[model samples]
Target: MSEAATRTVTTPPGLLASLDPLLREWLPRQRWFAGKGRPVTGFSLVAATELLPSTATLGLYHLLVRAHQPLLPGHVGAEQPGDCYQLLIGVREALPPRLAPALIGHVTQGPLAGRTVYEALHDTRPAELLLEALRTQARIGGLRFERDPNREIRSGLVPRLVTAEQSNSSIVYGDTFILKLLRRVVPGINPDLELPLALARAGCPRVPPPTAWLVADPEVPAGAPQPVEPYVLGVLQPFVQGATDGWELALRELAKGEDFVAEARDLGRATAEVHTVLARALPTVTLGHSQLRLMVDGMTERLEAAVHAVPALRPHASGLRSAFTALDDLAAEGHTWTAQRVHGDLHLGQCLRSPAGEWSLIDFEGEPARPLAERRMPQPAVRDVAGMLRSFDYAARSADPPQPEWAERCRAAYCSGYAEAAGRDPRTDPVLLRAYETDKAVYEVLYEARHRPEWLSVPLTAVRRLAASGLT
Candidate 1:
C-alpha cells in the first residue's frame, strides 16, 4: 500500500460552515488578500483536508476556498469566477497569550464550536509540521510535499513568520531556508519555481534554487478528465543570510547623499547574467511585425484604461500614446526584436545584496494580479531593464527633496554595466525601451491611485516627463 493510504485524511464535518462567519470578516483585512476593496459576499470550498483531525486537542486544516465578490460597474455576461485562496487554519482548545494576534475567532456552533482557530503559521508547533513533511516527502490527500533528496534538511529547525508587508506569507527556518507560501493561487506551474529550477540546473548563481516545494493536486470526479497540472502552493529556498534588498540599500544611500552608481552598475551586470542564462535554458522567439503590433496594442489599451480610472492621466494620454505609436511605426517597418523568458517583474525590491556584496534575484512570480499565462509568456529582455530603470527613478523621487541628477547617473551606469555583461545596451533600442518604461509607469500610476493616493505624484512625475519626451 502507498504511504498516503495508511494515513487518515478527512475533513471535519461542518468545519467551513462554522468558520464562514469569521472568515468573511477576517479575509478582507489580511494583507495578502487581493480583494481588498471588494466585500467577500460568500465562499465555496474547492478542496479541504484535515492535516490533523479536529478531534484532537490541537488540529491543522488545509483549505482552498473561492471567494465570491460582486462585479465592477460595467454589466457583464455571466458572474466572473472569484479568486481562490489557500488557507491554513489552526484549531486549539484555548488560545494562549502569545497566539492572540493570530486569532480568527472562537467557533460558535459546529464540530469545532467553542474551540479557538487562528493562523497556523504563527504557532511554532504547526509551522514545524510543514518542515517535517518536506523532510519526509509526505503526501496527504491532494497535498504533496516534495524535496531534493540530494539536499539534506535537518530534523529540527525553528520557524518564524516573516513580518514584512507582502502579497505572500513566508516562514524562515533556522536561517537556513525560507518557505514562501502563495496566498492567492492558480493552477499550473508557477514561474517562481519553474525559472529558478531551470537556472539552478544551468549552474546560475544569481538565483537561489528551490530545495523543497508544495503542490496541490487537482481533484476531479471519477469519470471526469483530470487537470494536467497542479497548483504550486509554496517554495523553499536557501536564505541569503545578512542580506539587504536593493530598495533599502538604495534608500539608505540616498539618505546619506552618497553616490550609488557603482552598486547600480554591479546590479545591472547581475541582472544581465541571469537574463543570459534564462535565454539559454528556455525557448526564445523573435517578435515579428504581427506580434509586435499586438504588443503595442496591449500597451495602448492599458494606457486608455488608466486614463479612465484616474482622471489625472487624461492630460498626458495623448503624449503617452505616442510612446506606443513609435513602437507600432517600427513594427510597420518590419522591425523585429528577440523575446525570451525574462523576469516578469524586475525591480530594486526584488534584488538582494549579501553582506559580501554579491547580488541575487528573488520572487519570479511577477505581478500577482496578472494572469498566470501572461506572466509566463516570453518577452524582450529590455522589459526587465525598463522596470529597473523606472525603479531608479522611483527611488530618486521618493527621497526628501528629489534628486534627478542622481537618478540619471545611476541609470547610465546601469546601462553601461549591462552592456559590458550582455554585449548590448538596452538604451541602444531607445524606442522599445521607452515604450516598455511608459507601459510600466502607467501600471504604477493605476496601482498608486487605487492603493496609495498620496504616492500618485511619484508615477505622475514620470508620466509628465515621459509624455514630454515623446519617444525622443
Candidate 2:
C-alpha cells in the first residue's frame, strides 16, 4: 500500500471520517476558528496527507477541511458558504505532561484506537520538522513548500509557538525567523505575501520580505472556470528581534504622560514611504464616477449591515448614510479619485518600532474578514490614513484614564507629518477622509459589539462626532 494509504491506520475506512466527530467539537473552541458563533453542521475533507509515516509511537498529519454552517435568514453575512482550515494533527499512544494543553482529545474507536491527538504546533519536534520541510522546499500531497533562493535557511533553530489573539497561528524559530501559519484560508493571492514581495522588489526597507512561503494548489479538472484560489498555507519572514508593537508603545507613552507627537509624526512618514513605494510598484488606477459610485455603494451596504448587527448604531444611521451619500454626490459633480495599492488594514497594532528607532509595517494581510479580491483591489490612500486616525482615538480611550485630547494632538501631528512626506495633505480632502473614517468606525461598531462590549463607546463616540459634523 502507498504510504498515504497505509497511514489511514487512524481509522479503518478513513482518517477524516473517524476524526470528524472530534473535530466538530474541537474546531469551534479554537481561537483561530472563524465560525465561532455559527453552528457547524458538517465537515468535508478537501485534502489530507500523512506528513510523517506512522511509527510505533507517532503519526504526523496535515489536513484541509471545509466546515459548513447553517445559513441564517436575513443576515447580511449569511451568504458565506463555509471556511476551510489548515490543521496539523500529531498522534501518539500518549502525550507528555508538558503537552497537556495541546491535547485535543483521545480517539476511542478507529483503526488506531486509544491514541491521543493534539495540535502539532505546540510540540517542538513537529515544529522543527515543519521548518525542515520548508527548508528542503518539499511538496507533499496538495501542499507545496517553497523558499526564496536568495535567503538562507539556517538549521537547529529552536521552535516555539506564539499564542496571540489573532485569526491565525504563528511560530517563532530561535527569535530569528517568524512564520505565520494561516488557519482560516481563502483562495487567490493573500496580500500578506503579495504586497511584501512587491515592496521588497521596489526596495522598500520599511517592511520585512518573505524568506519562504507555503501554498496549497489542489488539482482541478481541465478547463474549470475560475479555478479554486490557492490558499497561502503559511508565510516565513525575518523576525524583528527586540521590536515593540506600536500599540504597546503608544500605551506606554500615555502611561508616562509623555507626548507621543514626535513618534506619531515619524510613523506617518514611514507610512508615506511605504505608500509611495507601493504606488510605484503596483498597478494604479483613477477611480472615476462609476468607480466612486461603486465604492460609495459598498460603504452604504456595510453601514446598513452594521446598523442591523449593532443596535446602538441605529441613532447614528442617518449621519452615516449621509456620509456615504455625499460620495455619490461628489461623483455626480464630476470629481475623480486616485486609487493605488495601500495597507488595507492599518492601526497601531499593525506596526512595529524597532529598537534602532525605525518603524516597520507588519501583517499586510488586510482585514481578515474581507474578501481576498476586495483586499487586493486598489483603494484611496486615505483609507489607511483613516484607520490610523481611528487607532489614535482608540489608544487615548484605552489608557489608564481617558485622554481624548491626546488622541487629537497625535492625530493632527500624524496628518502634518504625512503631508510633509507625501507632499499632499490628507486633511485637504475632508469629504473623502470623512467617508472612509465613517466606514472604518462603522466596522468598529459591529466589531466592538460582537467581541468587546466594554469598548463599544470608542467607536460610538466617533459615530457621534461624524454625525454632529455637517460634512456628511
The candidate that wins on TM-score is 1
Candidate 2 clashes: the total is 0
State TM-scores per candidate. 0.97, 0.94
Q: How accurate is candidate 2 locally (lDDT)?
A: 0.87
User: Model 1, residue 148: displacement in angstroms?
Assistant: 1.6
Model 1, range 285-369, lDDT digits (tens) per residue? 9998899988998999999999999999999999999999999999889899999998889999999999999999999998899
Question: How much does candidate 2 score in TM-score?
Answer: 0.94
lDDT of 2 at 246: 92
Q: What's the lDDT for residue 112 in model 1?
A: 88
Largest lDDT belongs to which candidate? 1
Model 1, CA-based lDDT: 0.92
| Residue-wise C-alpha lDDT for candidate 2, range 284-351, written one tens digit per residue | 99988899989999999999988988888998899888987887898889998889999999999999
**Cα distance off (Å), candidate 1, residue 415:** 1.2
- Model 1 earns a TM-score of 0.97
